[model samples]
Target: SFLSIAIGQETPYKAVVVTDGHQALETVTHVLVDLLLLDYTLPTMNGIELYDQLHAMPGLEATPAIIFTASLVKHQDVIEQRKIIGLGKPIELDELLSTIERLIA
Candidate 1:
């Protein structure tokens, strides 16, 4: 649904989400090399971990990602890491909207 809509859109936009960590990584590495990713923290592999993996990749060194999590305790550390953004969960529409605006901008 979302992936299809994202790919089909006339604008320069595309997205994909896979709940499994291994699959997500593989998909990104293979199926979707050109995409900028926004992954949720509570996922099977955890968003921070995924971000780190992607960040280390040769072509992905400058790629952007947003991490959505339910825990504020981990927020400061992620922000301190300096390449990722943390969005707290319950996933409010306005908050998500704001984060997306900031991310895409």
Candidate 2:
């Protein structure tokens, strides 16, 4: 993916791809994630719902996240409520890398 390529070029960051929310949940429980890049549409649970679950996990409340979606509808309220960054789908590589850099820094 673009993220893997971009992040690879700029830093030594490793990307972990999860197929669904359940896998994401399991991964989070076992890993120490610095930042989260979540798709708004996921099987079983949506990004916001997954974020809620992650936030409720011990020691993850302040983890920075970026939620991306292809849909036109914007969940401004939920984004604000969760204090997470949101990105539109077909994410620009530069924008994604910049956001990731900012969040990780």
Candidate 3:
């Protein structure tokens, strides 16, 4: 995955890639996650819904996240209301790295 490779190469953090929300939930359930980089248009569940489920998990409630969406205008209100950092599709790697460094620190 492009995102995974970029993250792995650009930062010291570990990066894991899951194809869909189901895989995400499964992987995250076992592994400790410092930051969440989510696509708002995931299969089976939207990013917000997945975020809710992930947030409900113990020890992960306060975990930082960046939600990327193509339909930013459509989800603007929700993203703004939440603590999650919102990013648009075809993200700028520089911006993403900057946010990740700030949040993960």
Best by TM-score: 3
Poorly placed runs, candidate 2 (over 4 Å): none
lDDT per prediction? 0.60, 0.86, 0.90
Write model 1 residue lDDT over 1-105, tens digit each, in one string. 553354446335556656667777687667645444455554466666777777777777776666656775656686557566666665555665455556665
- Candidate with more favorable, higher lDDT: 1 or 2: 2
lDDT per residue for candidate 3 within 1-105, as digits (tens), equals 888899889999889988788898899979999999999998889899898899998888899989999888889889888788999888999999999999997
lDDT of 2 by residue, 32-105 (tens): 98898889899899999999999889988899999998762668678878888888888988888888888897
Ranking by TM-score: 3, 2, 1
Q: TM-score per candidate, in order?
A: 0.68, 0.90, 0.95
Candidate numbers, best lDDT first, in rank order? 3, 2, 1
